[model samples]
Target: MTDLKVRKLPWEFDESVPFQWNRENPRFGIMMNAVSFLAPAFERFIVSSTRAAMAQITDPATLEEADAFLRQEAIHGRAHRNHTAALVKQYPGLKQVLVDLDASYDRVLKTEPLEYHLAYIADIEATFTPLFSVMLNHQDKLFDIGDHRVGPLFLWHFVEEIEHRSSAKIVYDAVVPSPWYRLRVIPKVVAHVMGCFSMFCRAVDTHVPAADRGIDACDMIVRPKRLTSLFERSELPGQFEGVPRTEVITMLYRLARAQAPNHSPATEKVPAFASEWFEAYEQGKDVVNWYRPARVAG
Candidate 1:
């Protein structure tokens, strides 16, 4: 059995919340906003795919973990739904973007086999520990300066992802038991995720006003021509100037390692902030307003 806590966080977003929530890095903010667009649909896919695969997961402990994992993912879906609803209220055109994302995942669910879907989820979830570790490690730079509502939402999500780091792999191993197949499907999964992000960025570009968004929604995406130019110049663009070169290189290396068949997320080093957040939550501190004091002296 996995020791995962299904904490229901009270997250509320008001009209005052801005699209450029992270004032220090607008590009990062927009990129993460794209993730917010993707989360609900993607989590829905995860829940459905995992539920379908549960029949093959005969191990009682693994089955219990799967149930807990589904509960956490369901809660995450609800939180992200509230977040995206606020965004849609701000920019009604974003409604179409949500529709498009749902349709894309619906197509995948209808077309892909259960094995492929399980492998896809396993591959993606395997990367989160390392990926979110980097983000949480640098939270002072990336998240602490952002809107409290948005930053804490991502913090809660990422820490819980680390909490159940072994879940998808455990389920996949029980059902499919083919690391080669999981590795073989990585490219397709990466392409689909990037395509969804591309769709989100393009939608934001077309819909969210420039002043509100504060940067080109597509700035972080690696297009063909942009890749060629970067390779030729070996120089970072202005948008990426805020991020240290070493951190980027380290993140890439960790992500690559995460894809290995022998790679185990349990062995990976988690960020200190994750532990701190968990401690704070258990202590009944105000986790939703993470960066701000909950009360001021009179």
Candidate 2:
């Protein structure tokens, strides 16, 4: 059996942390903050979508995993909402965008067919699960780019994502077990998520001042690059400590292709650091400070 459980991590978002939390990489900070901006609403949707499907699942183990998944997502939403509340005070534009997103989710929950919601949740988990593994595997490298609190919050989130990677797939299979249906939904999910990310990035660029833009963190992925001389240099955000730009591009491509009939969450390999982090958790160490510069050796 897969080792899956909802972990109650003690991470408090420092309200005093600046909007340009990634001191070394402002673009990364913007992209991360954009993710934070979206998380509360996105996660709430996930929890609700999962709960809506719960009445159909009868397997005791699957039902237990689904419950844990819902608990984890709820906590995740609360944490991101708290952090985003602090962020909106610095960048008020983000709050409006979040409100709009919340309304959009509400509309979907109220009107969309149940299968569509389950497909979105399942495909998104499959796509993000591997990317979260990359983040964990490369955690040490990312430690230097952000404020002490910032990187760990993301790492903590990614760790739980890894822990419950199979829960959504289990629910998806239970509720909407049609490959053809899933295949149609995967493309829509990828396009929707990428579109949302692009919108968030542009919103940041529009609202934040120039000196703090950092690395145009995610624009390179969304827009085509113009050829430039070596001396001209690229403004793209640097790769997360250990993962390369190529790996990210590859992951995005795989996400786009994840609807293939052969793909299954059961076969996705868990990252080494995820296991290491859980062992530390089991040992009762403070995970919130897992990526502190003092704790990590260069």
lDDT of residue 260 for candidate 1: 85
Q: Give lDDT: candidate 1, residue 291.
A: 68
Q: Worst lDDT window (10 residues) for model 2?
A: 224-233
List ranges where model 1 is wrong by over 4 Å.
224-243, 294-298
Model 2, which residues run further than 4 Å from truth? Answer: 215-233, 239-257, 292-298
lDDT of 2 by residue, 1-298 (tens): 4356677766666558777787665545676787787787778999898888988888887788888888999888888887877777777876777787787677778887778888888777777776776666666655445777777778778778877877887888888868678778666666767666766676767766656655553453454353222113345544453466667766666665655645776667778987887798899777777656465775
Pairs that collide, model 1:
none
Best by lDDT: 1
Say which candidate scores most in TM-score. Answer: 1
Instruction: Report the Cα lDDT for residue 298, model 1.
Output: 15
lDDT of 1 by residue, 1-298 (tens): 6798888888878667887798677866886787788989999998999898897778899999998998899899888888888888889899998889999999999998988998888889988887788788878777877887798899999999999888888888888867889999988998999899999988899989988988777766777668543223223223343456677678778888877888887888888999999999999998888867842421
